[model samples]
Target: MREVTLTHRECVKLIGSPERARYGMVSVDGREPRRLTCLIVGDGDLLIDLDRERPIERPIAGRPIAVEFTHHDQRGNGGWTVTGLGLARPIRDGDKPIPMPYTTLTVGAFETGVRVCIARLTGRRTRPTQI
Candidate 1:
């Protein structure tokens, strides 16, 4: 496995495209994993919407966060591991505090690569990690 870092623009481009975007299972420094949908707004802010059943006990905005996942190459020959790390920012809902399950992230860097062979496997899109 190799480490890859993504620039803000690169991060935006990846998340901005619907075809490239996938629901990510994210954890903040080893916290319980949560389902998160990420997108880059036109203004270049990376928005992360969390799926949660309960209110957040504390503010997570400005906290450091990382997302780990596997993505297939265009040809589906191999799986490239990706990890996006950034600082959680806040998104406003017009006078309402940012909801418990939503956050805005300023993507600072990411690490990906060192492809793992999975082409021989069938019935699975990508191997799951124990994030």
Candidate 2:
């Protein structure tokens, strides 16, 4: 439950990497949370797959949204953080004459996934510590 931001360059690097299973909770315009499975497309755009557990309403493009998730490296070390996502654009898969209601968002902002916690020390010298 932390806030994070990622630049367009960083986002491209992340999504361009090898495929992996990454899951996160996405909130659009402060609406109810929804489960999201993201896949980085060849163009570095995020193909967000929505969970069908609950009904999904399409989000308007250019709306502010936030996503929180944990990222894992090849060594399997990652932490949880919240990211402020840029404008959300709705995208559909395939070239059907009729369009689906799925959505895809671009990585347009940047934020670090680092969480800093402060603790009060009793009977000990106060020092800065990061968790």
Candidate 3:
């Protein structure tokens, strides 16, 4: 099994698009549970670093989201689920979108069904990486 580990910063960079959500392709099976890139926006423990030079929203210091991505395979369909702590209400820190805590997201069809989760981490910290 191959695992794509993304740091907190990596997640934010992927979330650069302003469409609320975006479409990222990866070399994986086009079946249910295919790994893909996504942005989980909610009232989760994640935070938006709208203060950065590029200003990318990233997962907070403690919340790390588990992105289970999948696509259509011969057996069934395709989709992805980002599970973690999320928001309970709309989080707007200034003009940017701030995710809440404790939520689950499921995205599919490359555009049709997009799900974003929000979660909080107790004390998890991931180093930022350049995409």
Highest lDDT: which candidate? Answer: 1
Candidate 3 ranges with C-alpha deviation above 4 Å: 17-20, 23-82, 91-93, 96-117, 120-131
Per-residue C-alpha lDDT of model 2 across residues 15-46, encoded as one tens digit per residue: 43444224556666678867665544433344
TM-score of 2: 0.44
Candidate 2: regions farther than 4 A off: 1-8, 42-44, 50-54, 72-82, 92-131
Among the numbered candidates, top TM-score falls to 1
Q: How well does model 3 score by local distance difference test?
A: 0.31
Which TM-score value belongs to model 1? 0.45
**TM-score between model 3 and native:** 0.26
RMSD score of candidate 2 (Å): 13.0
lDDT winner, 1 or 2: 1
Q: How would you encode candidate 3's per-residue C-alpha lDDT over 1-131 as one tens digit per residue?
A: 22345444444433432333433322111222323434434332222222221222333222223333222234433222222333322234332333322224433222121223343222222233334
For residues 25-124, what per-residue lDDT tens digits would candidate 1 score against the true structure?
Answer: 5665457767654443442334454333122223566566666545666763444444556556555543122232233432211121011111111112
- What's the lDDT for all of these models? 0.42, 0.40, 0.31
Count clashing pairs, candidate 3.
Answer: 41
